[model samples]
Target: MTTTSLPIVSTCGTTGCSYNHDSDCHAGAITVTQGCGTYVDVAGEAGIDTRAQVGACHRSECVHNTALECGADSVAIGPSGGVADCLTFATA
Candidate 1:
């Protein structure tokens, strides 16, 4: 099923992600692949109020993914394989 609203990014532990501040994701939206496709390793911060939402998800095998979008109530991102990943991803 399709989700009416974007999924909230509850937390992020990607240390070098530009969208991450104080362990929270501030990107307007994030793309989930094997890793976080939208992760930027720059030296800046997204607006403090700009909480991230899942814009797209490529893990079709993930239970939280529906129609290329995230259907989870919330998702967490973290460091994995030297990149950001969707820690909430689970097999169907």
Candidate 2:
């Protein structure tokens, strides 16, 4: 099923990230890491827009992931390993 919207990008939710703003990501693309880059802190995540699309993802085992890229229309990112991470990651 389609996840992201047309233009609005599902930004990251990671705090202290260079691309994170009000719990939203503002990067052209993002790379999801294993372990430390998964899970969405809904409580911590803010300003999340469902109309965002996933530019690129690295969760190989994610159901919405394909070849290190996100198949989901959009994604949510957050803090992981001191970096912005994908919050929409789900096991395949």
Candidate 3:
């Protein structure tokens, strides 16, 4: 038998995001598109202490995306205009 862990959010630089605290994401799960689709602009907390994992990825061009899911060991997010972008994304 084998087990694998979901790709976790290793770091986040979107300070304006509600789920971001000290460059860490507490959103539980995040969606990756050209930017983070799960990003929230409000100033608050997700009320969760756990780090985020890639729930779904919409960038089929990203090498780390396997069947709309992140297959990397981990992922990083950063601010992009008013949203968050997947910094770990690479062209397939």
What is the lDDT for 52 in model 3? Answer: 87
Question: Candidate 1 regions off by >4 Å?
Answer: 1-4
Provide backbone clash counts, one per model: 0, 12, 0
Compared with the true structure, what per-residue lDDT tens digits does model 2 show for residues 1-92? 34333223455555554445655564444445663233334544333433334544556788987666666656655554555555566784
Off by over 4 Å in 3: 1-4, 80-82
Give lDDT per model, in order.
0.84, 0.52, 0.84
TM-scores across all candidates? 0.87, 0.56, 0.88
Ranking by TM-score: 3, 1, 2
Global CA lDDT of candidate 1, please? 0.84
- Against the true structure, candidate 2 reaches a TM-score of 0.56
Arrange candidates by lDDT, descending: 1, 3, 2
lDDT of 2: 0.52
What is the C-alpha lDDT profile of model 3 across 52-84, one tens digit per residue?
Answer: 888889999888877787888999999755468
The root-mean-square deviation over C-alpha atoms between each candidate and the true structure, in angstroms, is 2.1, 7.2, 2.4
Q: Cα deviation in Å at residue 66, candidate 3?
A: 1.1
Best by lDDT: 1
Question: How many pairs of residues in model 3 come into backbone collision?
Answer: 0
lDDT (tens digit, per residue) of candidate 1 on 33-89: 998888888777754576788889999999988788888998999986758888999
